[model samples]
Target: MSLKVVVVSWGQLTNVVREVQSQLSGEAQIELVEGLFDQQTTLEMARQIEASGQVDVFVSGGGNARMLRHNLQTPVVAVTVSGYDMLKTILQSRTGDETVYFVHFSEIIHELNDLKEVLPFPVNQVALKTPAEGEAFFNELSRQEQPVVIVGASLAWDLARRHGLKAVYVYTPKAVLEALERAVELARVRRQEMEKTQRVQAILDFACDGIIACDQQGIITAFNPAAEMITGISSQGATGRPVGEVVPSLKLEAVISSDRGLFNQLERIKDKEVMVNKVPVIVRGEPRGAVATLHDIVTIQKAEHQIRLKARREGLEAKTTFAEIVGESQIIQQTIAQARQYARSEATILIMGETGTGKELFAQAIHNASQRQGQPFVAINCAAVPENLLESELFGYEEGAFTGARKSGKLGLFELAHGGTMFLDEIGDISQAIQIKLLRFLQQKEIMRVGGQYTIPVDVRVIAATNRDLLAAVREGTFRADLYYRLNVLPLHLPPLRERKEDIPVLLRDMLFKANRALARYAPVIAREILLHLPAYSWPGNVRELQNIAERIMALALTANLSEHQVQELIGMVLQQGAYEETVKIKAGDLSLRAGERKDDLKKEIGNLEKEVILEALRQTRGNKTRAAALLGVSRSTLWRKLREDIS
Candidate 1:
């Protein structure tokens, strides 16, 4: 891209343009115009040159340069008079008593003064503050009696020559080269600025977010394509109009007045809900204007929903089904049939069963059989999380809702299970406050997030499960009656292992196969004699407990055998461990204390009872941490940590 340069000069100084052309880098193309020195005429000629084509820069001398700079859109570079030019002109002139007059612009008077000390002759200097002042000074000099010799700018020298006086033009080739160099640099900077503006405009047009910028007076200066779509106002109409008139909902004037930023403020523009963030554009500590970015609220919500759906398709899904429920007992079959029927309905279901009785399994099976089986099957244990954190775990929260919150917030289990089933395990263990919130969601099908102000509608089918007697909890005032009734709309009572002992053999065989695969063991069979004794014994921990015991027995032997002693010893160990745990429970619940027993004494007694149970389990397992942890339904780390705390 060649820089287009226009030079305005006198006919005598036409050689200056040739010299500038020689000094120019090949990046510039120069055109010269001579004898047009008047301000009005120079401005017209500059405009004509621009209209002819592109004019990146303009170069001229003194008065013509100043006029072109003020009147032309293209940048104008003025040829400056150097101190050396003034010194040379003074040295060639007349001496003292024969006065030499120097008429120049006021800004260059300091350069002329520096040359005064070097001159052997005294000279008179006249300073022209304005173009008008210079013209008047020239007229006064033309009427003088004595003929004067003058050295100054082109305009002053031309006026002196018209009045029949001798005049010397103070133009140097070095000054013209400097002006041309400056003009080239100015053109480069302007070109870069224009390119940057074009890039920013392209980004604003392509962005999904609507963008708008306003001057300090609230007149809209910019409106992007998205802004037009969101606000229903075209850029042609919005720009140059007051922002308040274009989009009255946005309080841009208020933002400018306060010199502050507002984020994620919901407003209605043209009947569309938008979340807008308005910020004052500050420059050098002063509020210059303001800018706003808007997002359609509905669009944002849909995008969030799509993200969750994609995540669900990638990993979160239910693997359980009715076929996975391994049981042949009448009660188990009846329970499965009732669950299948409930799966056809969208009502909330309450599954009542003891811990480890496969309540979650039933919930998953129900989801897998339902119409929304292909969607997410999210679950959360209400009892596992602390009360303070449970609400966020269930309903999620907005960004910056609390300390250490995720910057973009998080989706809760309920939100993740949209259009599907959400299994709220240990539902009865939730706090009364959370119960009220849950009941509200059950009734309204809407939930407000933790530390949020708006309600979000969810289409999730809730299935709550708990071992606690919700009716008893409701009667005791510990649980909300409304919530209990809401959850108990479809009640399911799962029979305990003791009541369904006929399913033990089948359950044990299936558990053994799974344990074999998981533990990398070759145990593929259990003795019939061992299976016969399992039905007579009460399986306190239900199917899960029976599965654990199957693993224990398989650890003893892999082949089928009729060994009553081995089965008897394993059963005795389990029964003894159950007895010890039962003693701790009974003692801990014992309200009637002996006379003179302090509360501290009762706590100590309970702690000692628990320690004794743990010790007996350790003894039965022969100090094996894994076996002892499984026997107590706890982890090995928990057992070790408990021992450390208790021993200390």
Candidate 2:
């Protein structure tokens, strides 16, 4: 990266430049050319050197330097004629009694005016403002009767020598060396500036965002390629034009005037919805200009959607559908049909059922059967994850949000589930603070990350499931009523296994078949005796409990056939002896026992205990329902609700 200096000179000055070049040890590379002022050949030669992109500055004298400066962008240093050069030239060119004529270009050298006091003889000074003027002076010199010694710049001296008159060149070797040094320094500076400009241009060309810059005068200084595409205007056409005239929607003038940045501004620009961000550029406490970055809103959304869907992000999947539910009973079919109808809707769904009742299974089924099947399906169990971690998992967290947070931050399940469904299992287990946030999401369809300063909108259908009665939790001030109502927009209740006994046999077969395929073994079929006795079984865990029994039996597949007692043992383990509970029914406010007379009708027995407790509470509180409810650790409304149910 040596600095290049081009010197256009001839005759004496050319010899001086060669002397300077030979003596120099600096980084500058001097190229000497034989040329004169206002010559087209010399101008073309300089332009070709510049076009090579290797030249930094041009060095010449008088009109030649001015010509290059006017025609080119590279800095041109005009070799200056000092008073010492002029005095030396005059003293050498004249004898003690001869008249001396000195020609200076642009202006008379005022420093030489004081030289008259030091010199023995008076010197006549002539100023030539232009090359034409210098040519006229030389023409007039040719007609003079007396032969006067002429001393002037390179152009003037060349002309004097051409007319066959004695002439002295005014430039010394020191003057040429000084000009070369100045050109080298200036070239270094100009090269640095050019490098900076080139880097900026590279960024403008490669950035994905549309970038436009305006000067303090509201004149567009830069319009990058992306901006050209966005605005349908060329950079060449936009630069130097008033920004308002080029793209008034930019409001660049307003941004500059305000001296404050406006971000995320959604506006219609060039017949397209664009997200614009404008920031005022300030340099040394002064407004230099304003820069704006534009993004097509539709383009941004499409890219995000494509990334969410095509990425098939981790922990986002639903493999179950209605056909996979493995149920044929009327109640189960009706529930599936209703869920199928609900799946077609965009409203929030609240699936209510006990634990081990396939709440999340139904959620996945609904998601698969819905229009958003191909999209993400995110499911999170509210009770399984800790409250703090659940908050971060559900809504995400920013980088450095807390100690040990990931530096890159996190994307929440809500964001991952964008354009799909988010199933919040065990929704009732979420804290009240989370309920507030969930309520906002169900109402506004937006979520704020754990450590985020902004809210991001998510287009996701919500389906919340819970084994706990959310309304009861709401009355107990545990679950938020607003959120409960939001999720209950499309409620789907799953019946327990005891209520849907007809599906037990069907479920048992499906579960065993699945277990067989999974373990690569033969599946054992439960005896008809066990299934017929299943009518007497009170399966608290619904079809999920039936699945447990099937898997247990499949593990004993090599046992040919299980005895009634062995089958009962496995069933007892699955239900924790729930299958042995005697059948009981309420008849006209009377407790009726069908299978046992041991007075173990659990519901009626609990009713009798509850009646005795209520009588005791009434006796202690003088029949004040509020006081009695408070003593029983229940709300007055709950006590009244129980009383109303008893009356009905």
Candidate 3:
């Protein structure tokens, strides 16, 4: 929308409105009218233009400008007499006289003296407080003996002409154009300010939190919709009233005086609990007002609960696949094929493998490849949790079931794994009481919580894993036979590192990259001789042991090429520490030894160490071989060989 301007002019400056219209034609809509500079005429014309709704501002000059500004509500811009206009009038009325009387309003007379040196003739400035006073000054000047030209404002010029005195009017086209430009610029600024106010009001109305603002005098200036709903007060009755009278619960006067802010403070508004924040509105280092915001506490808590649930659900999702197993050996390939076949069925799977054989890795791969891949893949280790807590962890509990039970109860792993896979690691380690309960769950596909009366059904696939032999436990009456057969519906065994020797190089490279990424450092290039020797040594702890050794070697910079003596020292250092010390008992069964001289030499050294350990155990047992075998964590037959001959 363009700015609309109306210019009211006197007859002396007749061409001013036309000049302003021509200059601001495309920029604004100009309205012109001729009228006397009287209060009645100016007020009537201003009201007529405002009633027509065409003008955003008004422009006039001299007495008419002052009258319009005083009596009209719309803005009135007075055409100012610029310094250039004064200079032009002085030159036009110039005579041989050095002293010319310049008369006008008090404000203009002061400006005339600033340009005194720029004029060719000296000027005597006369200031007037009223039109009558200006006419009296000109009438007295007309009686002078000298014929000095009178340079004055429009009012002064009219009085001088009536008295037959020479005069020049000070209003010029340049002055009129300047006034129009200022009025147009002011109109544009006011329009932008109005638009900004509307946008701020809309935001306040739509905000979710309650908002209320008060001036320093404690008068309510703004109350939003949310504030009305929260405080049980209407904006119509609250605005322009004292804040204490509208809402006595909020003490905004305290905030204004302290010039401080309170954040996330708990408050009760209309008997409903809420979190309130009150801050002082500071402008130019002084407090002018205060704003208070309220948020419902119950609503915030519900939002936080939903976020936690979503995070827990996402944490249980499986991110591994068959391709990430990182092995090419035939035994591993056969195990992967069986796992893939099991993924196509919904039967219970029992994976039997030694420790560190990647049982959980295979379980994750099966879940990711199955039809229920998009659902949760929850896992729990029966051996990791205490026996007293395992039953409740699997079946969940009801509210007030125990002294420390949650007020709202909790969902078990089985319930969380509904329509997905639930991997139970170390299944052989559960107590006899839990075994019966697990068997019932497998048979009926339902579970009863620790204190629940009704059974809850779950649609989950079970995958059980164990390093111990379940058949041996069953023979000893430590495990139930029925439970064993139920969990062994689809049995799969994972090969140990000894059986997958050919995949050591591939596993090493993959583990090195993982270590480098995790540690944020680069691994030195491993020597080819070290790679050859790595496959020869027995990794009793399987793939897990190999990964640990690779990380250790990378961290210690053992891969740097060195002399034969240094290589031997490095080998001895790794053997005496790290994975070797943890799995020394199983090295005999897992390692594949070389023939002839090299095999015999390493075997002799290992044999002497074994004998020394046995003798030390026997001394501790006081020469009882059976107790010594138990102390050494080995079978009696293995101990007998160490006492009689070298074990190779």
* Candidate topping TM-score: 3
**Root-mean-square deviation (CA) per prediction:** 13.2, 14.5, 10.1
**What are the models' TM-scores?**
0.46, 0.49, 0.60
Model 3, runs deviating above 4 Å: 1-207, 217-219, 225-271, 280-287, 310-316, 346-348, 374-382, 385-422, 430-462, 471-490, 512-538, 552-648
Give the per-residue lDDT digits (tens) of candidate 2, residues 22-119: 77667888898888554687889888888998789899986677778899877899998777776777788886466788876656667888897899
Q: Which of candidates 1 and 2 is the stronger one according to TM-score?
A: 2
Cα error, candidate 3, residue 414 (Å): 6.3
> Scored by Cα lDDT, where does model 3 land?
0.77
Model 1 C-alpha lDDT per residue in residues 325-444, reported as the tens digit of each score: 988899999999999999999999999987567999999999999999898888877876889999998899989999999876877778888888888988877888998899899999
2 against 3, candidate with superior TM-score: 3
